[model samples]
Target chain A: MVGIDEQDVVARPGGAASPRRVQRVPMGLMIPAAAGLAFLVLPLAGLLIRAPWTTLPRRLTEPGVLTALRLSLQTATTATGVCLVLGVPLAWLLARVEFPGRRLVRALVTVPLVLPPVVGGVALLLAFGRNGLIGRWLDSTFGFTLPFTTAGVVVAEAFVAMPFLVIAVEGALRGADIRYEEAAATLGSDRWTTFIRVTLPLVAPGIAAGALLCWARALGEFGATITFAGNFPGRTQTMPLAVYLALETDLQAAIVLSLILLIVSVAILALLRDRWLTAP
Target chain B: MIEGMRRPGPVVDAHIVVDRGTFRLDIRLRIESGEVVGLLGPNGAGKTTALRALAGLQPLTAGHVTLAGGDVDRPERRTWTPAERRPIGVVFQDYLLFPHLTAQDNVAFGPRRHGVDRRSARQLAADWLERVGLADRARLKPRQLSGGQAQRVALARALAVHPELLLLDEPLAALDARTRLDTRAALHRHLAEHPGASLLVTHDPLDALVLADRLVIVEAGHVVQEGDAATITAQPRTDYVARLVGLNLYRGTADGQTVRVGPDLALAVDDPLHGDAFVAFPPSAVALHSSRPHGSPRNTWPATITGLQRNGDNLRVQLAGPIGVAADVTPAAAANLELAPGQPVWVAVKATQTRAYPADVQPSAMTRDAR
Candidate 1:
């Protein structure tokens, strides 16, 4: 669509199939782009530079570090699972069904994406915590509370991360061809069968992308996880929280944790992007 | 599967009335088992709207649809069956063979949804693919299949359901000219084999003429003509139908052998018909003369050449006069006569070349009979 070959190679009189197309970046765009890249990469560079590489392996194997890292991975994965189950149906509703308050429902669905993570934690607490709305009934009925537990970490992470999955999946559903559904119906597929057999597979890439984003966001979550679930090392102290806690006593430990989180995210992103999202 | 002889009543019987903004489509249709009716119309004729209303994709504003002896949609009685519940299949214009599925799976989807087990469904799909002459391409996805191959897959998928009623919207319109010829022949075979009723919507006159058992021409949401291909082509009722069939036709009052088609214009026909009548003749019937020469031909008029284009091996000249008409001439004759636009020429037609019939049937009386 950009016609990169036409813009670059064809600009040269009759040079149609040049080995390399010289793409020019205007000074106005180039200067700001370079600055933006530097702004994002500088902190990661600093973390790597300050990392205690000599003791990195030993620190990574430490019980405290391993416990927090495991918790982070587990909570992030579980939260992504939760989002997939709940958010996908919500996305389908927003994309495929027409209702009186659909526009408002869609707007509300995206509220968590912009809401402060700390405020999100407070909202989750009031909704599901002790002596709160549904939490009171849950507490009285089951004697099971969510806050200050490992389960709370997943709940808090899911609450903060679900909007990403919902938005992406909804967009995918909206973009899918509705004519295929009609074809399926004519083939005698009920609405439920159509959704499971036709609609889901059609929007698989979007769901994958949304789940990835949700997982990544949940992995790095700090504000909501700590506020609602509390900073118990083995339960709620995820990588980001661990890094923040380590920063007070040892900068080297914090650098190592940050580097671990970065490596894991970048590796997963690179591998999945190539396998799923990259166009042939 | 639909039975050709055993069925007693029509496979589909419907009167669909749908209103979208100012456009209203009111059509009554009936199709006996094994009958393929081609719904032919110009753009914005509400052909697609009518198809959807019958398929239950869109709700009818009025009237009813009865398919396979069961009521499908009757707004007045509040009786309705959704598309999935109705025993119907639709081959969409683009085929819509699920891009993610193999050709086998695409065909199997219908059977599988209809409650056939997976392995048996796949077997049915293979048989269908073989019947459509795409057995070798069964493993390929829709994107990998050629246009013609995909068309077959769509047809197979629709038929795999064994629907009592089948709806095809512009089934062969997407293919290239060469592919269309073969595909049209194949589609004709398939439609014949399909014992259920079929209604195909198309703007291509050739597709309608060659594929349909009967042609139903609609214009501006109303039926303009309905008959067998030969009958419809021979006696096109409206100017749009006339143009589609490549005939020059006019309506006027008939006095004995001549019909006054326009002010100061009258054409002589072999048949003597009285009162309102229609006169029709092929473009090949008209002969052009550089000057007035009038012994053999009974009708002659001075006309100016408005346009000229190649129609097959002959040159089709559009003439403007009191009654506009098209005249086809050999390229040799066209060249020798110097047939260029704005050139004055004498047009002549033999009385025997034109046909005249009484114009007693009103436009509204012609229902594109497909129920």
Candidate 2:
């Protein structure tokens, strides 16, 4: 290293022109990179060009479109809230505490992330639908059944989306310096206080990012929401369900709803990326 | 073993014994109120473990920790108080200042945890910040502060709790040399003002001598020696402690002025000590000769250079002979003699330069005579 620095200085004294830049992009890398970009952008371009732009405003303001959009926004937000309350603590337990079968528990938490969405919906129905496992008791005791209700949509969305939040928050918690919590402990802060005041603040950025990802995933939920909630016009139908149903008979309306959801998701992702996450 | 322990009424009394599969640390200590005890040792000597046990962070396998007359932990009785409930504060080696909190808020964290209201906690934190000479930097985050500034903030945060016992783990280890000098001086003043029992864990001899009122030298897993700084430097009991104090030390049986350090090696000392004893002298006291000189010093021995490295302005050579010793020689002399590893040389130390004392737990006359 010293020799290289000395050579750099000697070369500078001789006034040698700056070394030529190596602006090389290997064919091996460029080909795959271009292929990946094209694969991702082609469908989006198709959606834009095939969109019924002339009738977009009229179609978007339809009662069905407005109701589905409102329901999607509300359900996704509520699902995210439920995930935050339950998943944050679960993530902390996985990250901070030592217990038997911890590896198995972590794998179990991530199972939903990889599980088929329709399978998750079927599982949710078996667990919470009338005459199903917990749903049988819930219905008999309180006359409550989750299937085909707005609450059922939220349950389906949360079941599928919670893994994202848990995984992100758990990664953040594991990366955090545990010594800060020890420092807090030495300063008379109890375990609960330390977790709230020090650990949570230290991982706040991770929590926010996880929450955003979870909300996005929930907003786009279609397989689980449709299977479990049985898409009803205003009560349980979300934007994705409406788009899918419109696709069979009204392709133009389907395109308008898809475009609206796409625009909203892109805007949110762009705004949050600039404000919270670093750009690649 | 250390003297002056089990004093009438100590603020902190701990017997820490931790057993990791391969290593076990058993250390006992008693620190009185208003006294700063420096836990000085080499790496992995269990100094930090002892400190952590005292602070209630590490639980002892079979020992007790008592602070300010309260038995906080006694594992035998299954009694334990967690770290948060202890009346103690710790300044971690790297400061471990909460990066998300401002200087004032960091200090206020302790006060708030102790049940002080928000306004009062901030007020107390501001006062401590002022005392640490960081009043104007209260709003700055830890990363925004310089190393010295961050260390002071950590100190203020620890002190804001008014802990009865303060534990500092290599507090000045992270600062640069110049910053360390200033911070050590400031730390000395703050420690002097603290009325609580303070235990400072550091490997730096200068920090120990300057900040601690008493020094405890630990080696491996136990306390080898503990005394005032002057006494410790004058007579180090172990090689690790000797190195920390920058001295050449050896244990031997002494007859009059001659001490037999090994089967084939004995050195003439100025002290008239008998029985088991220790002889110590500075590296500079060793002189090297290419060829044996006339009227040789009785302490002379034929040695081969084992290693050579620059220590300050002089070259420090490690020699292997009947007794291994370190000798410092001027670079000019080294170059003239072509001193290198494996080179044969004669080493000498005058009788007047070597001091011998009893190698036992007797700290009475030996300590006074050495001074």
Whole-model Cα lDDT per candidate? 0.91, 0.91
- Candidate 2's displacement at residue A253, Å, is 1.4
lDDT of 2 by residue, B7-33 (tens): 357888777788887878877787889
DockQ of each: 0.78, 0.83
> TM-score for the first chain of model 2?
0.92
Best by TM-score: 1
Q: What does the i-RMS of model 2 come to?
A: 0.6
* Lowest summed lDDT window (length 10), candidate 1 chain A: A10-19
TM-score of chain A of 1: 0.91
Model 2 chain B weakest 10-residue run by lDDT: B362-371
**Tens digit of per-residue lDDT, candidate 1, span A1-280:** 5798768755776567665778888999999999999999998898788889999999999898999899999999999999999999999999999999999999998898899999998998999899779889989999999999999999999999999999999989998999899989888889999999899999898889889989999998988888899998887888899999999998888888889999998987896788666842
Pairs with backbone N, CA or C atoms under 3 Å apart (clashes), candidate 2:
none
Tens digits of per-residue lDDT for model 1 on B35-54?
A: 99999999899999999888
